[model samples]
Target: MHLIYLDEAGNSGTNLDDPHQPIHTVCGVIVKDSQWLPIETQIDALIAHLVPRVADREGFEFHNSDIFQGHGFFKGWPWPTRVDALERLLDIIVTNKLPIVWGAVDKQKHKAKYVYPAAPHDMAFLLCAERAERWFKNHAKDDVGMFIADDTKAKSDMKKSFKEYRKTIALGNRKECLEHIIDTIHFADSRETFGISFRMRLTISSSGILWAPLELSPFLSELNGMYMQEGCFRKKGAAK
Candidate 1:
C-alpha cells in the first residue's frame, strides 16, 4: 500500500474575484510505504542541524508563509537561513527519489469563463487524487493508494467529491478514468501530520511561479526539476 499526502497551494474558494488567490492547486506527495521512515529520519536530522542555531525553537513546522515572511520563530532569522532550510527540506524529496502528483486550476480563468457543478477547490483536489491513483497504477500493481489532506470544514466536502468520483468511475460515467483509490481521505491539522506538512511545503514551494509575487525562480526551478527526475504527473494531461 502507498500513502499520499494532499495539500493546496492557493485556495480562492468559489470567489474568483479574490485577487490574492487567483489560482488554486492541489498536490499529492506520494512515496512507497518503505520510504516513509527513512524520509522522516532525514527530515529530523536536517531539523536537528538547524535547531541549535535558531533558539527557542523545537518541533518547528516548515510553513511557506512563516518561512516567506519570517514570522513567529523565523522573525529574527537571517534571509539566508530561511532559504537554506527550505532548500534542504526540498532536497529530502530528491535524496529519496519520491514522486509528486499535482493538479492546478486557474481560478480566474476557469471559474470566470466556465460553469461547473462542484467547487473549484474540491475539483482540483479530486483531480489531483485521480492523478495520484493513476500514477500508482502505472508504478505499482495491486497496491492500494490512500490520501491524507489538511483538516478543514470542507473536509467533508472533499470526501463527498471522492465518493462521487468513485461512483462515476465505477459506472464508467466519469470523464477521467480514475481508479485504485481508497474510500476515505484522512484529515488532520498540518502540524500533526509530517506527511501532510511535507506535501504542503512542496505545494507552496513548487507553486512559487504561480501566485506568490516573490521571485522564487531558484526555488521552483530546483524543486520542479528534481520532481520531474523522480517522475511527476504531466500537466494538463495524464502521467507520462
Candidate 2:
C-alpha cells in the first residue's frame, strides 16, 4: 500500500484568464507507506535549519509560494540561501527515490476551448488523480493507494469533481480513466504537518512539462507528440 500526498500549485481560482498565473499544476507525491515515518522525520528536523522567523509564534509553515515570495519563515533571507534550502529539500526527495506523478494545464490554452466539466483547478485535480490511479494499477495489481492533501477552505467543488469521476467510472461512458483510489481523501493542515509542507517537492518536474501549452510553445512540438503517445497525460475525453 502507498500514501500519496496530493496538492496543486499556480492556482488561478476561477480566473483561468489571469495573465500572471496562466498555468495550474496538480502534483501527487507517491511514497510507500512503510518508509513514510523516516522521510517525515528527516524533513521535520530541517524546519529549524533554514532562515527562521523571530516572532513570538510557536512555529511556521513551509509553503512553496511563501518561500519563493520571501514571506513567513523565509522572509529576510538572502536569495541564494533560500535557493539552497529549496535545493536541499529537493535533494531529500531525490535521495528517497520517491515516484511522483503530476499534471498541469496551460489555463489560457485550455480556456480557449471553452468546454469542461468544472473549473481549471478541479479539472486539474481529476486529471492528475487519474494518472496516479493508473500508476498504482499498472505497477502492481495488488497495490492500493490513498490520497492526503493540505486542507484548504475552498475545496468543496474539487471534492465534488472527484466524487463525480468515481461515481461514473464504471459506466463505460467515462473510460478516459478509472478511479482505483480510496473512497475518501484525507487532509492535513500544512501548519501542523510535515508531509503537506513537503508535498510539492516534485513540482519542478511537472512545471517543466506544463510550462506552456503545446499548441503555443513551438519548442515543445515534438514533446507534445510524446505526450499524445502516452495518452494518460491528456485531459478527459481527449485521448484517442
Candidate 3:
C-alpha cells in the first residue's frame, strides 16, 4: 500500500504593486508502507542536529505536529539559517529517493489577468493532486491512499476541488469508475488520526524545497532580468 501526505511552504501572494518578485511554489512527498519509521527517525535526527538545545529545553519531542509550526527553532532566525534548514530538509528527501513533486506558478500572469488569484494553498493542493495522479498511474499494482495533515484550511478546500477534478476526469456516472477513484483517495488529519492498522507508514518533508533551487538560479535570474530592463520594483512609489 502507498500513503502520501501533503504539505506546502512559502507565501502565494507577495506585495502586489511590486513587480520584481512573483513566484509561488507547491511541494509534496510520497512514500510507501515500509519507509515511515526510517523517514521519521531521519527527520528527528536532522532536527536535533539543527537545534539540539531547543529540543532539550522544551522537552517537546518532534512529531508530525512540528512540521507546520516551524519546529520551534526557526521562528525568528536570520534568513541564512532558515535557508540552510530548508536545504538540509531537501537533502534528506533527495537522499532517500522519495517521490517529491512541486509546481512553481508565475504570479505575474494572474496579476495581469486582474482576476481573483488562486491562493497558494489551492495551488499546492492542485499540485498534490497532480502528483498523486501521476503516482497512481505509474504504480498500477499498488493500493494507494492519501493521508494529509490538518495543517491548513486549504487542505479541506483542496479535498473538494480534487473530487470535482475526479468527476471531470471520470466523465461518466458509472459506479465502477467512482468506486475505483474513491478506493484510491483517502484523507486523514494526521498519521495518528488514522489507526496504524493500515499497512503504510508516513514521511514528512519541508515544502520550502519547492522553491529553493528555482529561486537560487533560473527563476531569480529571470526576475532580475525583468527588473533590470523595466526598473519595475524601483519605480517611484512602487509596491513589492
Candidate 4:
C-alpha cells in the first residue's frame, strides 16, 4: 500500500493583467508511509553534510516570504536556498528511487484560459492527485491512499474537488485521474515540505505512468532552470 501527500508553491491568485509577476507553480510528492522516517533521517544527514552551520530548524523553515525577500538566507545561496533545497530534496527522492512520485504545474500560460471546477489551489491539488494516482497505478501492486495537506481557506472546497475528480475518473475519461480516495490534513508549511521529509522508504506505485500536463511542463521546467541559475543563490536583501 502507498500513501501520498500533495502541495504547491508560488502564487496561483495572480491576475492575468499582473505584469510584475505571472507564474504559479504546483509541486507535489508521493511516498510510502513506511519510508517516511528513513527519508527524514537521510534529509537530516544531507543537510548536516551540505550545510553544517545552519541549525536543523533552518532546513524546515522555508516560507514564501523568505524566498521572495530577495536577500536573506535564501538569497545568500547561489540559488534561492529554498528552491535549491527543494531541488536537492527531489534529487534525493529520485536517486534513492523511493516509491515516491513528484511533480509541479506552472500557470503562466493558462492564466486566464483554463477554467476548472475548483479554485486555482484546488486545481493544483487535483493536478498532484492525478499525477500520484497514475504513478500508483503503474508502480504499486495494491491500491494507494492519498493525503493532501489542506491549504484551502474552506475545507469543503477541497472535499468538493476530490469528489469531482472521482467523478471524472469514474466516467472513464482517461484524460487524467482526478478522482481517487484522498484524505486532507492541515500541516505547517506546504505539503511538499512534509513529503520531502520522507525520503528513504519511498516507493513508486505500479498503476500507470504519471505524466505532467504538457502545457504546464515548460513553466515548471523554466522555474527549475531559474532556481539552478539564479534563484538558488542568496539574494542581497532577504530575511535573516
lDDT string for model 4 (1-240, tens) is 455554444443634334433333344455667777787787777667656776534645334344435454456654445555645655665555544333333344455466642245555555656656766566563665766552556556656666667656431355654434455443444434656343221111222122222322222233323112223233334432
Model 3: which residue pairs collide?
Answer: 18-239
Poorly placed runs, candidate 2 (over 4 Å): 51-57, 115-117, 168-179, 201-240
- lDDT per residue as tens, model 2, 103-133: 6777766777667624778767777787777
The order of the candidates by TM-score, greatest first, is 1, 2, 4, 3
Best by lDDT: 1
TM-score of 2: 0.75
Which of 1 and 3 is ahead in lDDT?
Answer: 1
* TM-score, per-candidate, Cα-based: 0.80, 0.75, 0.54, 0.57
User: Model 1 over residues 19-124: C-alpha lDDT tens digits?
Assistant: 6666678887887789888888887788778886555455578887788789976778888788787778777765675678877666656665666635678767
Global lDDT of each candidate: 0.68, 0.64, 0.45, 0.48
Better of 2 and 4 by TM-score: 2
How does residue 126 of candidate 1 score in lDDT?
64
Better structure of 3 and 4 per TM-score: 4
Model 3 TM-score, 2 decimals: 0.54
> For residues 132-176, what per-residue lDDT tens digits would candidate 3 score against the true structure?
565566553356556444345455566676676555443135221
How many steric clashes does model 2 contain?
Answer: 0
In model 1, the runs with Cα more than 4 Å from the true position are: 53-59, 115-117, 169-177, 200-240
